[model samples]
Target chain A: MARLREGLRVQLNVIQALTSRELMTRFGRENIGFLWIMVEPLLFAALVGIAWSFIRGPVNDEINVFAFVVTGYIPLTFLRHSFGRSAKIFVANSALLYHRQVKVLDFIFVRVLIESVGAMMAYMFAGIVLAFFGLFPFPADIGVLVLGWAIYIFFVLSLCTILAPVSEVSDVVEKLVPVSIYVSIPFSGVFNMASWLSPELREILMWSPLVSGMELMRYGLFGSAVTPYYDLGKAFGVSIVCLLIGLILCRRIRRTMTVT
Target chain B: MIETRNLHMDYRSGHVTKHVLKGVDFTIKPRDRIGLLGRNGAGKSTLIRLIGGVEMPTKGKVIRRMTCSWPLGFSGGFQGSLTGYDNARFISRIYDKNYSEMKEFVEEFTELGSNLKMPVKIYSSGMRARLAFALSLAIEFECYLIDEVIMVGDKSFQDKCKEEFFEKRPDRALLLASHSLETVQQYCNRAIVLKDGRATTYEDVSEAVAVYKKL
Candidate 1:
């Protein structure tokens, strides 16, 4: 028991250290440095929200296009960014493995953390900005929003866990990750509500943890005004399975990887 | 104490599988200065990497009972875009050492001065080596894994390194891998000669050097 506690403490220290390094290396010490973490995502979501609002002009009178885009894009950004970063993460940070205290999982964990935190901040910032303009409504169900976001974050982390290790072993997986994200965008439930889908399509889309998560998020934001179709149990179950598979694959890769 | 049990490592490039360490076994006790000797591609560095816990063996395990430093002169660990000070700070935090103290020690030791503020990638190879060596010394691990090419900069800098590793930390375990017999003879009491994916340890340094010369 004592040894386990000590191990956990050491792992935490390594994670903290790597987090600081990731921030510095990525953001640098220039103008507003780490602030860009929040700003970069916010700008991406804001631009997309405006463009999306203009592109799908007045489609649904009940829904605020700006709020819809902000809510959906924030989580989508987290997923896409996490996946994009996970590719070749292990290989890129191979130097860090030289330290006995640092593990391959630590690299993935740090990236996931950075993306999640950034996306969360962007979510709050966008909500505040839109609410100030009287365009975005305050979340009707903050509890549901938080819960849905947490589940989505878990799903992204699990997906990263799998990708980080697989990318280390295969160059093909690394090369295909970005393209895969673009292809999956439509089915990711970013632009359309689950209720808007036909019954046949909704059944297939509901199988996706991403769709379920987005549905829950929209339900939380728009409340009774929007109809949401999601099975929380199915989403949770799929996330758990993915998490287990990710952990197993990561463990196996750590055992065999040559940190050169 | 650090011990390796039947450690085997195989590297695969395309269709070729190079068996680096084939069931090699050894133990390193406290205060034991062992020299690792081998020809090029003889798995000398691979053995050090395995002992340092940087790489996993293909078919065995390394049991480490004490803290071990990474290969002392390896600059690959530093992020290229970050300044030298940032790299030192990162290492200090990870090792749970005093950040200000580590920075001071590295600054004094490396004497990089204004250069410390520049990105590490902009620094010369010698500068990177100096920073790595200084940071390793500041952390003060129980054992140090030194590669063959750690002797960087001029004679004064090399002397400083020797002083830091030998005079200052005499009781710490040293696993030095080098092709130079003189260095091994001067610093190590025991020697391990690696060949054909196996390692043979000799208590007498001269005898090990003699055997290594034959290979």
Candidate 2:
């Protein structure tokens, strides 16, 4: 157990180094090196909100579309980035993996850590910017808001790590990445609430852990009495299972990786 | 000490598998300057890759006492799209070392002038070689697995490398895989001749050269 703990600590250090390198290379020596990390996702959410506003009229009458989009968009963006980035990390950086110290899990952890932290900062920035513009809506229950974010991050990390090797081995998954986003549109519950759906559809959609997360987040943000039939316990369970599966795949594939 | 016990490696491209290394047993002791000599298809580079931990053996083990460094090709451990400086930063990050500390040394050794700011893909092969050689030397490692010639760089840079890397870093062990027998005689005291995925060590460098030449 002590040896495992020490090994994990060392892996964490490697993740930290890779994260720092990604941050530096992505932003460069510019003054706004890291601030852009916050700005990029916030702007993406804003653009999406603006585009959605054109079709949906005025977003939510009681709840501003900006805030609604942020709660949904920020978390979803983290999920997509984590899954997308982590899946291809081994193949993309095979050169670095040649070194014995640089493990496959270390690469996945670095990317997930970067995307997760970047998304978190983007959320905070979105909140601050919305508040400044009088477009902010405070969560009705802060506990649920924090819990939703935690669950979303956990699930995204697991999903990405599990899918990464599969994506690398087959070009089909890589091509379907964008297609998956379009498919996930309705299931993610980004545009609607669980309470608004028919009970059957809602129950089925609630099976999607992301939908449950989004619905719970809305309950916290809107302060409305919404008793979601979605299981938070299942969401946590699936996240752990996905993570373990990902870890197993990574261990099996590490030796087969060859830098092109 | 770095050693491979009955190492076997087979590579599969499509339908057929090429048996690259067939039960090769060799050991590299601490501070053992060994030269690897073989023809193109003699599994010389493959053996180095196995020892460097770049490729896993099919049915054996590569035991290592400490971390080993490998300079496999011209642009080793570098992203061509990134600038020279960015690549340096990436190396330091991967190794868990300080980047700023090696900045001056890299700048002096590479002597790439203003080209350091440009993407490495834009640089000439010699320039790329210089960058890789410099980066390898920048990081201190106990053992080095060098493939091919280091003389691909300019004359002055090559001389500087010998002075600093070969003469200065005496405690560092080297496993040089090269076709040049003269280079092997100059740099390596011991020789390992690999044929049909097996290694036969020679105490006399002349004997190893003769064996390789006959093949």
Candidate 3:
């Protein structure tokens, strides 16, 4: 028990150190460095929000189509940002492995954390801004909304974990991940809710943890205003399985990889 | 003490698998200044890397009871975009050492002056070596693994290093790998020579140096 606690402490120490170093490397100490994490997603959300508002003009007073798009868009933007950053991560930071204590998982986790936190901030900030303009409504239940976001973030992180290490070895994988991210965007339930689809289509789509996670978050935002179709057990089960496989891959790579 | 239990490491490049360390075993107790003498590609650095837990041995285990420093004078671990100070700060953070204290030592030891503020990628090889050496010394590792090419820079810098590192840390265990026989003889009380993926330790440094000369 004591050893486990000590190990956790050490791991946390390494992560904290890497986090600051990575921040400096990516953003630097210059003007609005870290804030850019939020901007990429915010810009995408803003553009989509505008397009949707123009097209639909809000079906009813209760459903703010712009708010719907922003909420859905933020997670998609996060997924895109994460996959974009995953390709060169291991090779670029392979040098840091010389420290012996800094694990490859720490590098993956730090980026996930940066993107997740950034996306969350952008979500709330976009909501506040859009609400100010009377184009959005606040989350009806913050707790459920956050729970849904956490599960979605976990799902995305699991996918990233699998992709990050694989990309390190295969150039083919590196090229394919970014393109796949764009191709999979529409299918991830970012633009439309599950209710918009027929029951058979919804059942098929919910098999994807990403789509199911999207429904849960949207449900949190709209409350009784919209019906959410998601299998909590299925979504969580898939994420946990992916997460396990990803962790095993991470460990396998550490031993097999040479610190060049 | 640090002990290796029949450690074996194989490196694969395409279809070729190079057997680096084959069932090599040794134990390093406190204050043992053991020089690692091997020709180029004789697996001196590879052994050091395994001992430091930077890489895994294919078929055996390394049991380290004492803290070991990463191969000293190695700059590959540094993030190139960070300044020298930031690099040092990163090490301090990982090791949980005091940053300001490490900063003072680095500034004084490296003598890179304002160059420490510049991104490490811009620094010359010599400047990088100084920062790397300084960062390693800042942490209090009981055992240190020195890479062969660490004897860099001018006479004064070398003298400062010997005075600060060698003379100061009398009781610390050291595994120094150098091509220079004189360096191996002067600093080490004993030595280990490598050949054909096997290691043979010599109780006398001169004997090890003599054996290394023939190989």
TM-score leader = 3
TM-score of chain B of 2: 0.94
For model 1, what is the C-alpha lDDT against the true structure? 0.85
**Chain B TM-score for the candidates in order:** 0.95, 0.94, 0.96
Where does candidate 3 stray beyond 4 Å?
A: A53-60
Instruction: Say which docking band candidate 3 falls in.
Output: medium
The TM-scores, one per candidate, come to 0.94, 0.88, 0.95
Judged by lDDT relative to the true structure, which candidate is superior, 2 or 3? 3
Q: Over the stretch B58-128, how does candidate 3's per-residue lDDT look in tens digits?
A: 98999989999887654567888889888888899888899999999999988999999999889877787
Model 3 Cα shift for residue A24 (angstroms): 1.4
User: What residue pairs are clashing in model 2?
Assistant: A87-A164, A140-A220
Report the TM-score of candidate 1, chain B only. 0.95
DockQ of each: 0.67, 0.43, 0.77
Of the two candidates 2 and 3, the one with more favorable TM-score, higher being better, is 3
For residue A2, model 1's alpha carbon misses the true position, in angstroms, by 1.6
Highest DockQ scorer: 3
The residue-by-residue lDDT of candidate 2 on B1-215, one tens digit each, is: 88889888888766899888889887787778899988898887778778878777778899999568865565446777678888887777667677887777789988997899898889888888778777778888888887785656677977886787678998888888888888889888899998877889998888899888999
User: Candidate 1's residue-wise lDDT over B1-215, tens digit each?
Assistant: 99999999999888999999999998989999999999999998889888888878888999998788887654557777788998898888788899999999999999999999999989987888888889988998888888875654677787887899889888899898988798899889999999999999999999999999999
